[model samples]
Every structure is written in C-alpha cells, then in structure tokens.
Target: MDQYAVFGNPISHSKSPAIHTMFAKQTQQAMEYGVIEAPLDGFEKAVGEFIHRGGQGANVTLPFKQQAFALADQLSEAARLAEAVNTLSFNKGRIYGDNTDGKGLVADLKLQGVTLTDARILLLGAGGAARGVIAPLLSELPASIHVANRTEQRAVELAVQNPSSKLVASGLDNIEGEFDLVINASSASLAGSVPSIRGPLVADAVCYDMVYAATVTPFNLWARQQGASRTIDGLGMLVCQAAESFAIWRGVRPDVNPVMQFLRAQMTQSL
Candidate 1:
C-alpha cells in the first residue's frame, strides 16, 4: 500500500486519518493513512524522514501550513496565493504543495445553496485560515469583502496582499454595515467563544464558522441569536477539503456527501 499521513503538532485530536481512511475504502485505493505528531521545532526533519520512508504525500495542519509551503518544490496557484499549503505530494524526489481549504469552503458553500456573486462578505480574522480562503472567495466576485481583525494593521495587511479595490479592512471593534455573508475564520471558536464584534452585521446574513463541534459552534450560536438567516459549521468544509486532497493524490474524485453524512452521524452519536 502507498503511505500517506497528516502531520501536525498536538495531532492526537485530528480527524484526518479517519476521513482519509474512509475515502480510501470508498475509492478502493491501496493506501495507508495515519497521523504524525512532529515536534514543534523539527517539522522539516520529520517531513524529511517521512519522505525517506517512501511516504507518498501529507496533509499539513495548524502551524506547519506555512512551513509546508516553504518546503514545496512546486506550488499550485491555490498554494501560492494563500501563502500556505495544506496538501503535499511527493514525486521523483520533489514535493508538490497545494491549498485545498479555499476550494473546499467554496464547494461547501455552493452545496449549501449559498450564492456569492455580487453579495457583501465579512471575513473575521486575517490570519492563515482567513488568508487561505480570501482569494477563492474573491474569485466568486462578491460585491465587496471586508476583513476585520483584532489588530487593524493585520487586516489592512491581508487586504493589501490581494490588492483588490473590492476588499476593505477594519478593526473588529469598528465593524459596521450589513453583510450578506459573514464567515468566522478566527480561532475564537476553538475556545468556545465568538469573535468579539458588534452586530446587526449578521442579521439576515448567512453565517459560517470555520470551526466545527459535535453541536453548533459558539460563533454560529451567536449568529443565530443575532437573527442570522442560516448558520453552518466547518464539518462539510473539512470533508470537502479532504476530498480535494484525495483527488490530488489519487487522481480520482470521491463523492463528499456520503463521507460528510457519515461523519455527521458519528458526531451526533458521540453526543
């Protein structure tokens, strides 16, 4: 079987192994997928050893996405634009990197029947997670996009990175105006807290929390309390992104709906 894995620090909680295992079974691919917890300061060393052991590819998470980007011998447009890489394929002594997060988000949104064209978008947080998805969202040609962060300068910096007249930046405290789509790309949801912001912003808008829990995320709950039209968590995004990575490695696209439904059922039962 070909070897594949996901690498990260604090990787014990990762769902990548299970997700990929399901995909492998569904596609009847002869592959073994697992998780590797690399030491914080030794990500490169771990990757080198994995490649030495005939590892075929890897899914990178958390702090290592940027490092994976730097380690790539070649990058896809998605990886280059995001300045981060979440999927890596090794071939003929070279590593190819790509970012599937943005494509995953867009795919999930489309599956949910959310329209992006000519709508206003509010992106919370300007960090890697936010950066990875901005270009893809922009491709959907929203009327405008506003990136808000705790630090005003980071938001400004992110907006400037893409250099779009349709994009704007603001501090979280000063966020105003109605947004047809509000996406929480911040780490706040991991802490069971919503990103601090004033609203009227989420009112009647579709809200997406890029974090998923067995139940609704705190950000989505807050959006619901604020009378948002719809709220979605990141489970579908996770499955879609994993599917993209599988396609990259195996050259075949597997259906994501079944995997997503299976995972959702598991989450429900675990509760």
Candidate 2:
C-alpha cells in the first residue's frame, strides 16, 4: 500500500487523514493516510525520513507549508505563486510541490452556486491563507479583489507583490465600497470572533469563512446576523483540497459529494 500523511505541528486535530481515507476508498486506490506531528524545528528532517520510508506523498499544514515550499525540488504554478506548499509528491527522486487551497476554495464556491465572473471580492487578512487564494480567485475574472488586513502595510505589501490592477489593499477600518463576496481568511474566526469589517460589506453578499466548526463559524454567524445572502464555512474547502491531493497522488479524482455528506454528518454528531 502507498503511504501518505499530513505533516504539521500540533496535528492531532487534523481531519486530512479521514478525508483522504474516504477519497482512497471511493477511488479504489490502495493507500493509507495518517498524520505526522513534526517538531517545529525538525520539519525537513521529518520529511526526509518519510521519503526514505517509501512515503509516496504528503500533505502539509499550518507552519510547515513554507518549509515544504523550500524543500521541494520543483513547484506547481499555484505553489510558486503562493510561496507555500500544501501538497507534495515524490517520484524518481524528485519532490513536487503544489497548492490546492485556492482551487479548492474556488471549486467549493462554484459548487455552492456563488458566482465569480466579474464579481467584486473582499478578502479579509493578508496572511498565507489569503495569499494562497488570490491568484486562483483572480483567474475567475473577478472585477476586483480588495485585500484587508489588521495591519495596513501588510495588506499593501501583499497587493504589491501580486501586482494586478484588479487587486487593491486596505486596513480593515478603511475598507470601502460594496462587495459581491466577502471572504474571511483571518484567524479571528479561530478565536470565535469575526473580522472587524463593517456589516454592510456582507449585506446581500455571500460570506465565506475559511474556518470551520461543529456549528456555523463565528464569521458566518455574524455575516448572517448582518443579512448576508448566504454563508459558507471552510469544511468544503478542506474536503475539496484533500480530494485534489488524492487525485495528484493517485491520478484519479474521487466523488466529493458523498464524502462531504459523511463529514457533515460527523460534524453534526460531534455538536
């Protein structure tokens, strides 16, 4: 059986193993997925050991993404753009890196019937999560993407780095103009808080929080309270990204709907 795992610090809470296991079973692939809680300073060593042990590929999470990017022998366009690697494949003594986060996000949005063509998007936060999705989001021909961060300079820097006329940056307090979609990529939701943006930004707009929980995420709940047209959490993104990685490793895509339904049921049961 092919061996795969997700590497991260404090990885015990990750659902990647379950997601990939379902993908493998659905696709009839002979593989086993697990988690590896690598030490913060020993990520590279851990990856080397995994490769030596005949590990086929691995998913990366949190603080290890950048390290994975640096460790790869080559990078996919998405990974190059994001400067992070969430998926890694090993073959012929080469490590290939890819970033499926943005693709997963876009796919989930489309699946949920959210329009992206010529839409105005407001992306909260300028961190890695935000950076990983901007390129993919731009590919959909959105009219514009306004990146807002707590630190104005960081948002400005991120915008400058991406360098697209359709992209703009601002501090949360200075956000202006209405958006067709509002995405919370900030860590606020992890703390059970919503971003500090004005509620009007979400009024009649679809709100997406890149954080998921047993119930509605804090950002999604707040968006609903503010009259958001619809709200989506990151659970779909997680499953979709895992499916992408599974396809990369197995050369076969698994049906996501049944897996999504299963995970949703599990979340509800945990509540």
Q: Which candidate is the best by TM-score?
A: 2
- 41-105: candidate 2 lDDT, tens digit per residue: 99999999999999999999988999999999999999988999999999989999999999999
Task: Give residue 83's error in model 2 in angstroms.
Answer: 1.2
Write down the lDDT of every candidate, Cα atoms only.
0.93, 0.92
What's the distance in Å from true for residue 93, model 2?
1.7
What's model 1's TM-score? 0.97
Candidate 2 is scored at a TM of 0.98
Query: What is the Å distance of residue 202 in model 2 from its true position?
Result: 1.0
Please tell me which predicted candidate would have the highest lDDT against the true structure. Answer: 1
Worst 10 residues of 1 by lDDT: 190-199
lDDT of 1: 0.93
**Which portions of model 1 show Cα errors greater than 4 Å?**
none
Candidate 1, backbone clash total: 0
